[model samples]
Target: MWGRQMFHFLLHWMLGAICFGFLVTAFSVLLSQLVITVVWCSLVIGASIMQDRDLSEYSPTGSSTSKHLSCSHALCEESPNCASPKQPCPYTANYYSENTTSTGFLIEDILHLASSSDRGSKRLVQAPIIIGCGRKQSGGYLNGIAPDGLMGLGLGDISVPSFLAKSGLTRDSFSMCFNEDDSGRIFFGDQGVGTQNSTPFLPLEGKYTTYVVGVEGFCIGESCVDRVSLQALVDSGSSFTFLPDNVYEKVSKEFDSKVNATRTNFEGSPWEYCYKASSQQLLGIPSVTLLFSVNSSFVVDKPICLVYGTQGDNHCISCCFFEV
Candidate 1:
């Protein structure tokens, strides 16, 4: 069946795994959709070998099902360190974090996928995908940032979704939906429903590398900041939302002027706008909304998040805003 094989996967809050007969787990795997390349840490080259102290426990053993990709492959041309046609393809990917990088060789492996059929039947399919067998990592990777691996869902020929599409297994599209509990589902080849709200993906540097969207501005209750004209990346990998210093100042000032809660500081917390308030008081706080083009808006129903004390008690409400 053409374009009927829609792959599905489950997503946890901070961790997720794709079922491939066995599990391939990663830290922030589902949320790591912002990355441009799919890279998994090799057990032999994991944090145990690294000089850094912090590292993830999950690591997959080198499987016999995988084989090194030859440099002659068309995908090898995209590798920055492809040398000889007879050699294994080498690749290196850098992250937004300073000094963070994943360097390794490319390998071809069969991904076991489960798809639902038209008659509500389930079928298993095996598709070949190109993945980076990370032999070494630096910086954030050692600091618990996707220590196990990263399954990149960003636009690229080497990404898992792209490989599936090129193999004629499904359409070139995917969707990710996260619930309030942080659990979610990832559907490959899904075009989404007609009634769903949508926004156009803008290009970056003449190319679409990651999910970039144009923002008209932000709104804190009735007061709105119009024409801010911010182009932001829709990054689920990041735990907190970040804004420019100028924009952050404008937003923080507006929110502080309207809220009745007293501003206080929480030790060891990065949030600058912490307030001493009760659960009932938090409910009265104004909602924040991101204004987009074509009457589309993303609303944050709960802007104030609870910051717990050392004893695990709800001490204060903090606005999740990090300056970029």
Candidate 2:
């Protein structure tokens, strides 16, 4: 009877200990809830910090933070928007310097007459043209103004040039030599020979895309001038070429002896003229070449066929168009 009474006493002591443990656990949970309500506004951040999670220890600094801080989540951190603070800009000082990686105009990916297999190809047989200068996979296009004012080429019909061909035709280096005269206008110097405008065929890597190739050569005839550069646009959709004002005066003098050479159609515009140059004459015309410090020199030798007005005398034509 004394041993049975000792067993009941042991059971009572165990029950009391279990009740004390339950009270202490309930108090701890209430205190934790109160601390979180007073300290944190969100559950995830509060719980993670309280638990001392591993992700909470990470902190982005330097360019990593700067990149994401000012940008939206849509942009990639590796883009120029997120440039590393450690990497310096090559264009910080002189932007047009030789060491800088420059961008040029993207050219429209249209095949020339040499590559065409139809009548449209034959019409542009000797027109001055420019091919794309970069790879196809890269997102780029030809950007230029039609001096002839004719626009009909669709965006879908073009194709980028082969990489090997583009590389061979464009500047081999990433550097461009641009100069501004006292007038603050840009000038293109061909191997130290400066032109009033940007040099032809100097494809900047990023700035401009492939533009139409301009024609440069002496006009042959009665009133010919030796050094004339005709800004020519090769349009497969057109049947004729158009020249601006002062440039035409010099060219007309070469074709017709009676043509007046002193007339400037517009105030200070360059005279533009067009003449039929047979393939034989095109071969004889001095090769118009643009030499880039980076790559191989581009030479233009073609017989450009231009449209003449009903009056027959040199009249400024607006644009050249043909039936598709």
Candidate 3:
């Protein structure tokens, strides 16, 4: 009962801050095994295409020219009291106005994962996927990475992790290891990473089951932001870090003061404070750290880095964070 309540509070609380990452779950596969999927949004002019016949009446601008566009639920045209055909369909996700429609824009496909074996039969695993057409993400450091959608690692029947477990190809466990040379690898099945930093995993059993961790607080520079034993989700799929409302306000303030560089002049930088990267600019940027709680009296420090990328001529000096 308490677990469910915590998940409920987290769901409502997370909306106040945009804490999602590029991928909800980290990609894991045996060495050299192709066991992950990428969910990138936005289709090119002709690079890829999907069928959405339901939205044939909508123009590129989302305006409806056909007065015959009726509500799908009613199954027929309405009287004068009903929604006009010129207006958007009242039953669709877009209410009564010609606006962005998700029906005709989404697509799906089958993905096959290759296993680590190479003896006789290739360990081939198949997974289902959903795709969508939309505008690519831009600006800030995320412009390059987030333009494509995330490969889902959430706790859903269709998520990549679930696919592996469903196919009997894996035991639903994976680990990631990073080397000093800027390269890393993921291992699946019973091959887990050996570490003493492991903690309790709270499996959110609601609509979106996600990997959430217990967070006590964050130590930023010399200041520590209080988290009051609230929970946080660790999603490497994201390009930036998101903090809860109360925690964010305090952390951002400390980060801003510590950096002390001139604010970025770029128009579309998503970070709250952007500074040009230089010898002097580098001095102002400080390392933001994370503190996690494993049990009573057992705490761990998660060292976080803040290295924002460039947008055209500007060189960003901090990673993305959100008040969400």
Candidate 4:
């Protein structure tokens, strides 16, 4: 009877210890899972709140720094009527045309003038003749013929003849667009020779369309919408595109406000710059358009080339292109 009693006591203790161990293990598992859930929720909520705050700071209607102004408008502030009714925007010839060469003029005149020993005198004569034109300054030069064998022109110390040879549009057959008038109008063809203006002489429109559109504000992105269109130049030889400092600030803010937005920070580039893109609205920012007037008669479209960050907190870079 004692032995039986002792057995019953031992069995009872063993069962109680087993139950206690199971209860402790279950409680520990549940508590650990709850802690993990709470931590994840906190992180998500904090991220959402931070994003909202950043967006709030960037809304277009919010503050002076939030607003976007174009390069022309910025220039206007310093001079009366620079922006609008107070001042009249300057006007020039419109050179944009499906076919500028069809407007018959002298091709020989352009060649004779450019070939002159007197660079200064020739410039005076040729400057007004080149149409749809702007000057380009480049450190290096490359020559290649248009599909039709027309020679290319760019600025460098290289001799024009040697440049032409390198391009394959040897002096024997290539004609440069040497006579573009101030209105961005260009005229080309071998003058006094059997050569006439070639059709589709320069495929400039295709090459520079991106650069022009970007400058004109046709691009869609947080920063592009907030920054006003600024001065545009057609640069074919630049390694990449650039924008002024003021533009980068307004663009950078847009990405910072959104979750999963690409960082608009440039630390690994040969040049320091940043960029961001999104599909939503930011401060009612509007798209931009650029117009090019040639010979005060035609208007053509330019393309966006590049977008990058500037050094200043509010600085940005913008560059556009025009077809040849």
Q: Supply candidate 4's per-residue lDDT for 221.
A: 33
Predicted structure 2: lDDT? 0.25
C-alpha RMSD by candidate, in order: 8.0, 33.1, 13.7, 35.8
- Using TM-score as the measure, name the better of candidate 1 and candidate 3: 1
lDDT computed for candidate 4: 0.24
Candidate 3 — which residues are off by over 4 angstroms?
1-114, 117-150, 175-187, 203-208, 234-238, 260-270, 280-284, 295-324
> What alpha-carbon RMSD in Å does predicted model 1 have with respect to the real structure?
8.0
In candidate 2, what residue range of length 10 has the lowest lDDT sum?
10-19
**Model 4 spans > 4 angstroms off:** 1-229, 255-324
> What are the per-residue Cα lDDT tens digits for candidate 3 across 106-171?
223444456665365666555444322233322221223222233445455534566667767788
> 273-300 in candidate 2: lDDT tens per residue?
3334444433443322332232323443
Candidate 1 clash total?
Answer: 0
Query: Who wins the TM-score comparison?
Result: 1
The numbered model that scores best in lDDT is 1
Total clashing pairs in model 4: 64
Rank candidates by lDDT, best first: 1, 3, 2, 4
- Residues 207-321 of candidate 4: C-alpha lDDT, one tens digit per residue: 4211121232323332234425443323232323344445434433432333232335456543332335443422223332322222111111211113444643321123312
